[model samples]
Target: MRWGEIIRRLVLIPPTLFGVAVIVFVLLRVVPGDPIAMMIPPGATPADIDRLRAFYGLDQPIPQQFVTWLGQALSGNFGRSISLHQRVFELVLARLPATLELALLATLIAVVLGVFAALIGVQLRGRRAEWIVDGGVGVLLAIPDFLWALILLLLFGVLIPWLPISGRIDPQIDIGFHSSFYLIESLLTGRFDVANALLHHMMLPALALALPFSALLARILKTSLAEAEDQDYAQIARARGFSRPEILLREVFPNALIPTVALGGVQITLLLGGTVLVERIFSYEGIGNMAIDAVINRDFPLIQGLILTFAALFIALNLAIDLVVTLLDPRLRHG
Candidate 1:
């Protein structure tokens, strides 16, 4: 990537984050529920209410509150959750890894399946094989993640009983608090049994989360691959006596992947946000589940922190994808 692009991405980060902060701060406050009212004991006196409000800084003017929160946020302080009574930063960090693990596993499944399916569609062209792939993609895309989660739970958890119905692992295993991330902790502790068990437990939930995204990616990839195959360079490669597989592997795949990379960035945000329902269904202890619980309990600080973190991650992923695409495609490097 050029220096201009690098500088541009860096410059946009602050304004984008500030916009997110402003929106979360203002809209959350504007909502009907009062955190102080929710936090205080039932039948508490006006004096008690005022004291609690002042304690949490909710009595201040909205602008001053925003300024105070923003300053603390910049210094890595997001305030304590009214519901959980824990620092918002620490609360999120604790559960973030579970969400990351789920998201990464789902993305891996999606990309692998999507790319291969697209490749098959491109190769088969107008044949029944291509039609089959297209139809399958359509069916998968038609279903939402939560529905998939329920269906998978019923099938694998109830009907077949092959996988554990809920939770990240069997309670018998003491995975310990050595690392916040379960997978990493398992590996570091040399607990292969726990690692295997974790992967097995994760499969159904990951597949549930991944299938729709894979379908969307497959559709995009098939179209892009077909277009790439028709390009002059692909034709030139064919003229040079390269086989179909060689042409696809060497020439078509890279060009076809550019749009997929961009779409994948968008999918990252969707997958992360959608994890709330999926996590709740699977009984997975992740930030998405935390967010859901926070909402139910009226935790404003926790909600703001989760939204800001997710927004920041989404923006950062798009930036990274843009840089990757620019680096991969020579045409993008110049313009």
Candidate 2:
């Protein structure tokens, strides 16, 4: 990418973030429930409620409140959680690792499986094998990812009872001052046993998140691969006695991958959104679950912080994807 284009995209990030911040701030204030009301204890007088509201600065006009909050937010101060009484930023950071780990594992699974599936679908086009793959993709896409989580939970957690049903690791294991990533910490500490347990616990949730993403990616890549297969260079390469696999590996796959990389940002957003459901079902203490709790308790600061964090992540991931796509396809660098 040209320096000018890179600079332009970077400049857009702040305005996008500000728009999201404004929307969340306004919508939360307009909603029915009062955060102060939720915090008030039983038998508390009106004066007590007023005092609490004023203390949190909720009594201020909406415009003033938004300006104040936005200013604080720019400085990385998201204020205290109304319910938890802890710093919103701190709570989010604590839970962030689990969400990132789950998202990374899910994306890895999706990319690997999706690419292979797309290759198979294109190579075996019009055959029973391709049809079967198509049917499977259709099935996966038809169902929501959370339902997949539930099905896996039922099959493994209920029927087989093989994998641990809930949580990131066994409660019995006390990993001291470790990194938030369980497997990494376990490996670093030379506790192979704990690492093994962490992997086992993670598999089901990761699989639950991966299935739909993989299916979507496969469908997109399949179309791209098929189109690339008919391109002039691919036909020319075939005419030159290039093997089928060579033509695909050299010419088609890379083109297919460009579109896949672009689609990957959307897939990641889906995975992040799906994390809320998956984390809840698995009882995983990730940011998704924390966001859910924040919403339920009407914790405005926590909710604001979570939404902003998610928005920033989504923007960053898309920008990264654009850079990757540009690198993979040199034409994008100039365009």
Q: For each candidate, what TM-score against the reference?
A: 0.93, 0.94
How well is each residue in 1-335 modelled by candidate 2, as lDDT tens digits?
77788899999999999999999999999999988878789999999988888877899999999999888877989989999999999899888988998888888898888888888888899788889999999998888888999999999999999999799888898767456777666778799988888878888899999999999999999999899999999999999999989999998888878887887666788788899989999988899988889999999999999999999988888788778888888897767
Off by over 4 Å in 1: none
Provide the global lDDT of candidate 2 against the true structure.
0.88
Each candidate's clash count: 0, 0
lDDT of the candidates, in the order given = 0.88, 0.88
Top candidate on TM-score is 2
Residue lDDT tens for model 1, 285-325: 88888888888877889999998888887888778888888
Number of clashing residue pairs, candidate 1: 0
